[model samples]
Target: MGDRLLEHEELLRELAAVQDWPLPKRMKWAKRRRKEQFRHWKRWIETDEAQSKCARPRKNSNPPDLKFASEIVLLEASARNDVDEVIAFLDEGVDPNLTNIDGLTALHQCCIDNCVDLATVLLEHGANVNARDIEMWTPLHAASRCGHLVLVRLLLEHGADLVAVNSDGQMPYEIAETSAVLLELQEAMEKNGFDDGAIEDARNSGPLQMLSDVKELCDRGEPLSLADAHGVTLLHIAASNGYTQVVECLLTNEAAIDPRDRDGWTPLHGAACWGQYEVIELLAEYGADLDAVTGTDETPTMLASDQNITLLLHDLKTRQLERSARNKSRPRSRTFSSSSRGHSVKRDSVNKKSHFSKRDIAEEGKQFKADADSTTGDVDDVVIGSLDDENGGNASESEQSVFSTDSAEKKALRRSKSPPILIKTSDPIQEETEGENNGSMAQRDNVVQAALAPSTLEGQDSKAELVSKETPPLRRRHRSENTSGKCCTIL
Candidate 1:
């Protein structure tokens, strides 16, 4: 046997690698490695240490009595507050960590049922407070979600993980159903040394609670126009989803009515595209710009899905244009009124001064000289006194007349405020005549002329006009053509 085993050592190694060997091949190898066949080769092949080193533990081979007949039954009994059945199973040596098919332990059931006494009994018998179910939901997550504040507090005291996230990326505190549950979780977190951010997280606990937290933060001096990573504001989210109350709350806090996201989509654009009728009307009432174009040149009216919204935006645009026209017309009346008032003041001053003649002016001057000599003042002082009127009231009138040059000043002021008018004409014969006379060509699409203010010169409005000679318009390439040397259409 020793000689045979020594000779077949390499064959045995090969046999071990072949998992699907024939039964005869397996039996032959098994017979050689048996204790009875290895008397002299015991130290090398048949020792207990060598056998143990090469042994593979059997898979799922537990004794039938050791496995529980019903783990879910035990959990159900524990959840229903049947303390007797729970104690009977624990005393019968049932595994405390035995979970149902969904991986939920008995303590998780107790949490969902809000059975505090059952939770205490299971915890005493070594139930895990942080044991996760199929969705990675801890027992505390179940309790928090169902607004079981007392069970949440009890689980926290038993050392549950505070920040464990479930399958939905939500913490137990984040999905807490009621404010009471959220507050209880927050207090527990605070006692465990968490700071103010924990309380803030509790305030923003659930999906619907996020909106209320936004308003509270605004009241606490946070900016209502705060934007997220995507540059989406709270109003954009609320308006897009038709949260009319949240939208009104945000607008009442003075949020920007037309804040645009990174995609150049305003809140009005979002509401319009989603057909949020009330939100669209609220945004329009707060003065959202209807004509504000997006990055793709699409206006709110163009993006709107509802015909009513489109018509409303159209009316807003028309009203805005009319208002701008009225504003432009108002400046002309203001200019004319200012000019007439200046002329009236000048005429009044001229009539009052015309009453004194040149002879009266010389006689008054001699009388003032005699009074100056009688006072015995300096010669320079007497000369300065002679320059002043006796009553001193005419000095201010003279100063006003010196500075009021209305016609030239008003013309220059108006010219500086107004932009130049752009003109275009299509008459080829007139263009040729003007080009030949002025030594320049006229642009076909746009012609910008610089004109100075009008002045009274030989019964004509005299103004110096400077002409910036036109350059040849660049030819555009087809959409598919290369723009290597030509100007590309800039977005």
Candidate 2:
């Protein structure tokens, strides 16, 4: 079996030397050749004496030398998390600091795998904690980039440098997923009297670039309020995009509610012109100026659409009107003349059957009778004096004062009974005599009447029926139509 194994190894070496052949054909030939060689070796091993001799080692042959014992064992253990095998190899004498082709030590692998226990063991075995990979990534860097908080803490506790830059110029703490971990590391460094200017430098970036950076910072529970190149803050972006959740997050963080961009437009103005009702509503709730006019003298209300936005504008206007009306209605102290305080007459007793009571009827009657009785008394006196002088004075006085009180009362009643005067001209009125002259007024009246008519009683009932027919029926079957599947019945 030993002779057969030697022959196979020799055959493989010969195949390796045949590089002049076509690549594909050579590969095919090599495969077949190896298969034949393996079959011969198997036949030799099946023989009883050959198997026994192959199992035993020759007296003159020594064991193969193990190279870089500690380093290789650590690498294997780091890969597999096998502490016992690693310790044995270290005891067999190997340099702990030996690096692979990439200059990455066992500690780097443990960090990459987030294996804190194995990493601790490597450190205890005198492994270089600060050794960097070809990419200049230390075990600490690997741990941070992978979001391994425990490994990060362990490395920092063991004096890992927080400010070491990798190929991408990111620090260990800067790459950490948890802001708490990064902050704790920074505090520890500060407490230990290490300069923190490096950490501050690592966090610096341009505004637009910071959008992505700020997002990461926010994910790490860090505080950020970065603005872009155009002087637009995160709130502006959120409002422009109509990202309600993002907007809410920014607002919750107390971001400026009315930040203006380079264009001098506030978030409310942007939301208004863009037709974002929800965003506009949110901004309004946050006390944004709905009446704020732009450089063009266009208010947010003017930029809004005619649908529900009108309702919002109407509410704003109504509130303003109410405020103005209240101011106008405020009473002022004033003085009046005696003539303004005319004669006061006592009212008669009220009668239940009368819609306006007896006092009102008496007032009406007094107004209608007026000065008619006064003239009658004068005429009576003239006639009486010519015939006889005895009853002349009394009759003349009675006739002269006949309706003196009633005349003034009648004029007052006429003014009181007049219909209420229309105070506003918002609604148009049609002059019966100008039917041909004012076509617009007639059309307006017709439109108003049509609008005032009840929709259910309008002539469009047949059209409504047609529309109902065009509409699709509800997909969900009613229980009344299929009683067999009904869960309940009213009867």
Candidate 3:
């Protein structure tokens, strides 16, 4: 019998090795061999069954090893939704709390999969509700992350810790996306007398403060370094909201100008990304570093768009230039080493001017100023020139002089004329000296100063000063006119 079995095995192995055997021939031979093997196994089983029935074996099919049985039952029960088979096994001596290699129990699987009914059954059967997986995620954490609001509420009501953090340091509420579910879980926790100290910490950390509080601090001139629960400063909050006034107030108070948040975002980055041009300009004016990189290695200037943030950036560049000129005027005995030359070159390239004729512009400006002075008396007919004169002198014909118009006509010409040829030149040396002079003269004009002042007590003083200096003669002329008209009528 052993020899016949060996011969059959040899034949099967030889047939398997046939590279070019026809499919029909291979199937026929394999079928015959399998039939013969089945016949032999049937005879052996029948003989054994007869003997086993006669003797009655001591153990019924040798119960699986206790540990292996426990592991298999646990794995199968946790993976499948049907709990009947799992419950039967548990009743038959399988441990309900058996953890796999990852320390995940059946309850963890049920919660993660949102099998609320199965989870309830498991809990009733004494499964640990707070059993943690490999990531130390409790069943409540799994339910919250899965957005199972009912399961989350159930778990919380049953005394699941609301503030328990997973390996990722996120609480159940932090992971939950649905506001309704989060609120329900929170309410359930409160009903169960569970306190979320972490949430209270976040609220008290100034994140929940009224806009008035922020404004009051700004009004009272309080700094913006006030840290919240997560160590985020008031600048961080104001920047996130793009609150221009709040940001301006915080900046004026000398807030930590560019302190990075936990995510390494400075106020300038937030302002730039959110298209808050006013806030961005305020931040830049207060000495926020444009070149400073975020945690993602993106600079504020890199994130700024030409459409939304161009004006802000242009203003920043202008201020930077003004600041550089100011600093240059101050005596600095420090010598520039060779290594520092590269950094200086890079800085200068950022605001480089295109090739243009400043001399021609200066000549045009002189001509325009001479024309302006000559036509001041007849300013009503004096036309201003075009920014681009190459367009066939058409715009030059429209250039009108301001001083040539009569007082009544001048009052009608109260509208501002073109920006006064002052912004056309690119030379910082010339721009600083000339622009400063013009700006200072404009500042001295009390009427212009009063018009620019904010409507406050400070503005009222400015308005009074302006009235005394420039408008007194006009006021007197009106009074004289009224007096003369009254006297003539009486006569």
Candidate 4:
């Protein structure tokens, strides 16, 4: 046996060095290693039960009584998920890890059926979480590949190996039926301190034996999406088989919503060709491409075949095209707001400030000034000032702050009460409002000033501003009206 093993190692090494291993030799090596590991595990369990727990401890080759283990009744009860019956059997010393003819433990059956209660009980009763079936599939592999989230978590909590590879040489993560299960497995792997590269090596057996295609579109290009022989992904299979529950589960987990097959057929195309009506609507809701063309230059609608389904696809495509067209054609009016200086105020776009057009401001200022010049003091001032009084007396309060006193108290009060105002004056800020206007002249000046306020802000020029505090979105008002600084602080 030793000489045969040595000879086998040399032959395997030679084949590996030449990169020409045949499938039979590969399977042989894998089987040999597995059997040896199984024997090692059994010996370790028998010798080291006090030291550590065995994951899949083998039974004695010649047992005093084979009655306790290898019973099919426990497995049958587990398959039924009859918690009471399983509990009764476990109390009678029926091993929780008993294997049926297929070498599946009762725990494996519980996982396959997603029997949460039974699984929890089995784990509590010292069932081996990493127990493998004949195919080398642990309970974790069964739960994960079945897309059972709760079962997967239950298995993980019980110390199920996240990176365990089954007979197909795929890890639990590789064959996760749902995106959510895949994420859970990945997170567990990460928590166990497995880096991405380490995990990949475990899955693919290190970097040099890259079975994936090396056809890079460019050195930094995105990986080209690949599929199996027929380019069929799990989603394509579920859709074509009219598996509504599976399709819904995949979509809800955000599987690739519009992956194309080798024939350039999307899952939608498969659903259409197979006359899966609910699937078509579901895919549309999830934003599948309705107009996606196949390699043969046929759309899903063209292949729908059924008249009602064809009309449904047609309507969905029309709506999708309309939405896209509207998006492309609709002007982004809210993007570039009109700036008072007529230059694009791109910076202030985020502030959402309403600005007046330079031309419009100039026109309104001229008209208001003309009106003030024609009528003496207080006429429009009385009308506009009353309208500006907002909240019934805000304008009057501002008036008192501006004209009541020129003392420091008044200055402090104004500063505390209002936002800083922008005033066009070379004089000191205190002096700008120092002297009082006599009668109607004062009222007329106030109205004219509000109307003809500077349309341009000059950095070099000296100015005093009584800007109001910014608040909510400004209500749109005609530039010809409501020129009061206090009235439109938010803008």
What lDDT does model 2 reach?
0.60
Score candidate 3 by lDDT.
0.61
> Candidate 4 regions off by >4 Å?
1-70, 204-491
Better of 3 and 4 by lDDT: 4
Each candidate's root-mean-square deviation in Å? 30.0, 32.0, 29.1, 30.5
Score candidate 2 by TM-score against the native: 0.28
Clashing pairs in model 1? none
| lDDT by residue (tens digit), candidate 3, 385-456 | 111122343343334232232232232234223222122212211221456546644443553343334542
* lDDT per model vs. reference: 0.65, 0.60, 0.61, 0.65
Clashes of each: 0, 7, 13, 11
True-structure RMSD for candidate 2: 32.0
| Model 4: lDDT of residue 250 | 65
Cα deviation of 405, candidate 3, in Å: 99
The lowest-lDDT stretch of 10 consecutive residues in candidate 3 is 482-491
lDDT of 1 by residue, 281-384 (tens): 78877878887788899988889887988887787678777877998888564444557565564344655665545445545544533443332222122222
TM-score of 4: 0.28
